[model samples]
Target: MLPRSWVAGARRPGPTPPAARRSRLYAHLFLWVMQSWLAMFYIGAGYAKLTQKHDLLALMMTWPAQVDTELLRVIGGIETALALFIVAPLMSWSLFRSVMLVGAAGLLADAGGMVVFHTLNGDIFLAAVNCVLLLMSLIILLGRWEWRDHAQLRNATS
Candidate 1:
């Protein structure tokens, strides 16, 4: 039989094992870095879209001219909101953890749409950027997912 002290940490959580603690620390660091990078990227892009006129923006990218002014602004607002929401968990209480998932999912959808829109507009660089954002979004989404005890929670709550 296994030693009494060697039981799963989840069941007996007086203190996490050293290795588990280190691993959890590393995971949190990784997520924080990625979240910061993504939030900055979206914030900058959204700010540019929101502040600059289409004529000025068109000089930077071809699509701004074709897309409606209101539509572009709306996209910009959504991007900014998504970026804020993604980092909300870090700033808020544990009850807000689910906000990260919602934000990541929304960013993923936004990136997916950008990929299609950029590809159709023949902007290869923007499409590639969209792909990178999509990958990052996926990484954050999967990394933060509460895989452990998710099934148990559903049954326990109900």
Candidate 2:
């Protein structure tokens, strides 16, 4: 059997106790905050791309040049869609957990790519920003995965 400290830290893979539940609640709360932050951030980014304003001009003017207008809009649309994905889980939509997972995964990929892109463009600061975002997305992904695993374990036992 596990040691007491180990057991307490491990918790079981079944129904959550009060302390476990509290931790889960905190995780959910963090998820909500992340979801909100990512949704707003992406939505605004996508909006800027769609409208060809703000960062659009910068995108056109800067390192990765000659990005087509329509392309920008399409990228924005995808970003906005991902933002909606994050929001759905918050609203407790039936398929939202999966959707949020997918969104987080997508953002994780995006951030990782941006990190490389920025580094290649000699924009160390931008690369660092994306690296931070990548780590943040990763934290959300892992936390959500833990929660998902517990939920599935609970269901299977039930």
> Mind giving the per-residue lDDT tens digits that candidate 2 earns over 19-127?
9889879988887787788778888877777776645467554732545666667778888887787677756856688888898898888889889888988889889
Model 2 shows how many backbone clashes?
0
Model 2 spans with C-alpha error above 4 angstroms: 1-16, 53-56, 59-66, 146-158
lDDT of 1 by residue, 40-139 (tens): 9999999999988989998888888898999889999999999988899877748667887898999999999999999988989999999999999999
Candidate 1: residue pairs that collide: none
State, as a TM-score between 0 and 1, how close model 1 is to the true structure. Answer: 0.86
Among residues 3 or more apart in sequence or in different chains, the pairs in candidate 2 whose N, CA or C atoms overlap within 3 Å are: none
User: Once model 1 is optimally superposed onto the true structure by TM-score, how far is the C-alpha of residue 18 displaced, in angstroms?
Assistant: 1.0
Residue 98 lDDT, candidate 2, scale 0-100: 86
* Distance from true location, Cα of 45 in model 2, Å: 0.9
